[model samples]
Target: MSSTHHVTTESKPVRLLLIAVAAFILSLFLLLPLIAVFAEALRRGWELFLASLKEEEAWSAVKLTLMAAGLSVPLNTLFGLSAAWLVTKFRFRGRAFLLSLIDLPFAVSPVIAGMVWVLLFGAHGWFGPWLAEHDIRIIFALPGIVIATVFVTFPFVARELIPLMESQGADQEEAAVTLGAGGWRIFRSVTLPSIKWGLMYGVLLCNARAMGEFGAVSVVSGHIRGETNTLPLHIEVLYNEYQFSAAFACATILALLALVTLGIKSLVEHLSGHTSNSRH
Candidate 1:
C-alpha cells in the first residue's frame, strides 16, 4: 500500500508540469504580437511617439472612441441588467427566445450587423423616411456608432448575471418578504450585494468591447477623420496611410486601457469571492 501511494504521488507532479508547459506555450502565442507592437513603437523613438500623441486626428479619434464607449456601455449595462432580471426572475412565454437573442451579436458577423443597422436607418430603409423627415441622420454619425456598439455588447451583463443570480437562489428574498420588507428594500439589501461583482465584471467586459469595437463601427462611421472616426478606425487609417509607428502608439493606448479594466475586474471578483466565503 505504501509503495502504490508513492507512485501515485510522483505521477501528480509530472502531470502538473505538463499542464504548466502547455499554458506557457499558449500564453506566448497570445502575448508575443502585443510585445512586438510595443517594441516597434518604442524603436521609432520617444520623439516620434510623442508626435503621434500630438497629432490632431489621433486626439480626435481618442475623444470620439471614449465618447461612444461612455455612451454605449452605461446604456447597455442598464439594459442588460433589466433583461437578465426579467428572464431569470420571471417565468414568461418566449423567455428562452429572448435569452437566445441577447447572444445574437456573438454569432452574427459584425460587418453584417452593421449592414442590418444601415438597412434599417439608411436613406432608403424602413425608418429612413421618418428620420429623413425629421432630418436626423444615424448612419455615418455618432448615433450610428453608439447603436452598433450597443447591439454588439448587449449580452455581456446579462450573461454575467444569469448564472450568478440563479446560483444565489430566491430564498433570501422570500425571507425578506416574510419579514415584511418591501420589494425595493429586499433587492437593495440582498440581491444587489450578491450580484455586484458579476455586474462589475460585465461592465468591464462591455467597456472593453465598446472601446475596441472595430468592424461594425467601421461600416457605419464613414471613416470621417477628426469627426466620426474611433480609435480602431484611426489605427486602420494610419496603417493604410503607411504611418506604422503612430498606429502602434494608438493601439498600445487602447491595449493598456483594456488591461487596466481587466485588472480592476479581477480585483473586484477576488473581493467578492472572499466576501461570499465569509458569509457562508
Candidate 2:
C-alpha cells in the first residue's frame, strides 16, 4: 500500500519557528524600509512633505517618469504579443535564436544597455555627426530616457506570455480560422480571451519596471534637472544634496506605487485563480 504524509501533521513548534523566521525576514527587508521612508518623509511635518512633492523639479520628474512608462509599456506590449504569437503559433528557422533574442534584455545589464545607446547616439557617438547636423537630440533627452526604460522593461511582457501561449496551443485559433474567421477576429475572439490574464499581468510588470528603472535611465539621462530627470533619479539627486526630507518624500511616492502594483497583482492573481477553479 502507498502512504501519503500530511504536511500539516508536522511538529507545531517547528512550524511556528519557521513562520516566525519568515515574518522577521520580511519585516526587516521590506516592511521596515517602507516604514522608514514614510517616517522620514513626514518628520518635518505634512507641510514640508507636501511642499517637496509640489516642487517644480519634483513635478517635472513625475511627469517624465509617467511619460516614459506610457511610451515604453505600450510598445513593449505590442512587441510581446507579436513575439509570443509568432513563437508559439508558427514554426520557422532560427526560432530558438529568436527566443534567445527576446531574452537579451534580461541577460544584459541595464547600465550597459544605456551606455550602448549613448555610444550610438551621444554627441561623439556613431550617429553623432548626423544627429548634430539635423539638430536631433536623443541622448540626455526624453527620447533617451524612454529608450532606456524600454530596453530595461523589454522582456517582461513577452516572458510572461510565451509559456502561457505555448501551453494554450493554437487549436482554438485554428478552429476559428477553419470556421472562416478573419485574422483579427480569430485574435479578438479566441486568442485574446485565452491570454488576457497573462497579458494584463505582463503589462502591469512592464509599467512598474519602466517607472522604476534607474541604472539604464541614469546612464542616458545626463540628469539635467526638470528635463532628463526621472522620479528615481530625482530621489537620488535630493539625497545627494542632503535634502533628507525631500528625498524621503519622493521615495514615498515610489513606495506607494510599489504597494499599489503589489495590490493589483494580488487582485489579478486572486481573480485568475477563482476563475480557473470555477472552470475546472
Candidate 3:
C-alpha cells in the first residue's frame, strides 16, 4: 500500500494561529458586509423589500443588466474560442504579440476603457459626426453599453481557454484529421468537450462581471434610468439619493449573482479535479 501525507513546516500552534487570524479577517470584511446588506434590505420589512425590487426603475435596471450580459457573453465566448484556437493550434508571425494583446483590456482601467469609446463615438468624437449624420448612435446608448462590456470582459474566456488548450496540445485534433474528420467535427467532438468546463468557468465569470460592471458602463451609460442604467448604476443612483434601503435592496441582486457565480465556479473546480484524478 502507498500513501501520501502533507507535512506542515510550521508548528501546530503557529498554523492554528494563522488560520484563525485569516478566518477572522475574512469574516470581518466579506461576511459582515454581505450580512449587513441583507439585514438593511429587510430592515424596512418584507413589503418594502418586494416593493423595492418591483419598482419600475429597479425593474428597468434589472432588464438592462440582463440585456448587457445576454449580449456580451455569447460574443465574448465566440471570440475567446477563436482566439484560443488560433493562438494555440497554429504557429504564426507575431503569435506571442497577439497573445499578449488579449490581456490589454485587463491592464487598462475600466473608466479609461469607457472613455476610449466616448472619444471615438461621442458627438464631438472622431466618428461622432459621421454617425450623427447617419443618425446612428453608439455612445450614451445601448450599443455603447454592450461595447464597453465586451471590451472590459474580453480577456476572461480567452485567458481561461488559452492555457488549457495549450497544455492539451494538438494531438487529438491532428489525429482526428488523419481519420478524415472535418474542422467542425474535430472541434465539436474533440476540442469542445476538452474545453467545455474551462469555457463554462470563463463564461460564468464573464457573465458576472458583465452584469456587475460599473465604471466603464457608468461613463458611457449616461445614467438614464429606464433606458441605459444597469443594476450597479441603479444602486449608486439610489445611494446618492439617500435611499439606503432601496440601494441595499438592489444590491441584493448583485450579491446573489456573486454568490451564484462563486457556487458554480466551486462546483466546476471540484468536477475538474475529479476529472483529472479519474483520468490519471
- The candidate maximizing lDDT is 3
- Give all candidate RMSDs, comma-separated: 3.1, 2.4, 1.5
TM-score of each: 0.93, 0.96, 0.96
Query: What residue runs in model 1 are displaced by over 4 Å at the alpha carbon?
Result: 1-13
- What pairs collide in candidate 2? none
Tens-digit per-residue lDDT, 1-280, candidate 3: 1333345678889989999999999999999999999999999898888899999999999999999999999999999999999999999999999988999999999999999999999999999999999999899899999999999999999999999999999999999999999999999999999999999999999998999999999999999988899999999999999888899999998899889989999999999889978989
Candidate 1 per-residue lDDT over residues 82-129, each given as its tens digit: 887777777889998998998999899999989998999998889999
Compute the lDDT for candidate 3: 0.95
| Candidate with the larger lDDT of 1 and 2 | 2
Which residue pairs in model 3 clash with each other? none
Looking at model 2, how many pairs of residues clash? 0
The lDDT per prediction is 0.89, 0.93, 0.95
lDDT per residue, candidate 2, 72-102, as tens digits? Answer: 9999999999999999999999999999999
Worst 10 residues of 3 by lDDT: 1-10
* Clash totals in order: 0, 0, 0
